[model samples]
Target: MKKGCLIGGIVLLAILSIALGYYFYQQSKTDPVVYEFESPVYQEIIKKTVATGSIKPRKEVQIKP
Candidate 1:
């Protein structure tokens, strides 16, 4: 009985090891990464600004209850 158990345990371990090895081997067979790039284009940019009137801050404050 002991010998049978030992052989069975060894066979189970061997099967597990082979399964893991095959999984990693398949994982390593994936395709490599690919990258795509485009050239930069030049363009003229115009900026304009117009301002009128004055700005002022509020003068009221309330405390929380």
Candidate 2:
């Protein structure tokens, strides 16, 4: 019947629309344009340093009762 044909057409259109949307979504995540450029200048960079140690004394004190 004509109703069955209409339903079939609607289903086909919906499937095609979803497929095209997913295809375009996958294409937007690529970085082809941003990776082609290089930096123009370079500079000297300094990093932070850390020191760790323990101190010792010559005599020890005792408490009397």
Candidate 3:
């Protein structure tokens, strides 16, 4: 049936996507890009991706009295 085939195709694509994502994630874990910097020249890092305007999180410290 056409409906059965359509559902099967969607399921197949979903499984393929998950498998590909897992493979790429595993590869990145082992072979990630690393950037080392001298203490002074580190300000040039791109704070966020160009399209999205998100900023990095700041550390927080709490004082207990």
Where does candidate 2 clash, by residue pair? Answer: none
lDDT of 2 by residue, 28-47 (tens): 78766655678788888899
After superposition, the stretches of candidate 2 with alpha carbons farther than 4 Å from their true spots are 31-65
Best-fitting candidate, scored by TM-score:
1
Candidate 3 lDDT by residue in tens digits, 1-65: 99999999999999999999999998878666799976755456556555757876698788899
Clashes in each model (backbone N, CA, C under 3 Å)? 0, 0, 0
lDDT of each structure?
A: 0.94, 0.90, 0.86
Tens-place lDDT digits, model 1, residues 7-50: 99999999999999999999889798899998999988999999
Candidate 1 minimal-lDDT segment of 10 residues: 54-63
Model 1 spans > 4 angstroms off:
32-65
TM-score of predicted structure 2: 0.46
All candidates: CA RMSD (Å):
8.4, 8.0, 19.9
Global lDDT of model 1: 0.94
On TM-score, the stronger of 1 and 2 is 1
> Whose TM-score is higher: candidate 1's or candidate 3's?
1
lDDT of 1 at 47: 94
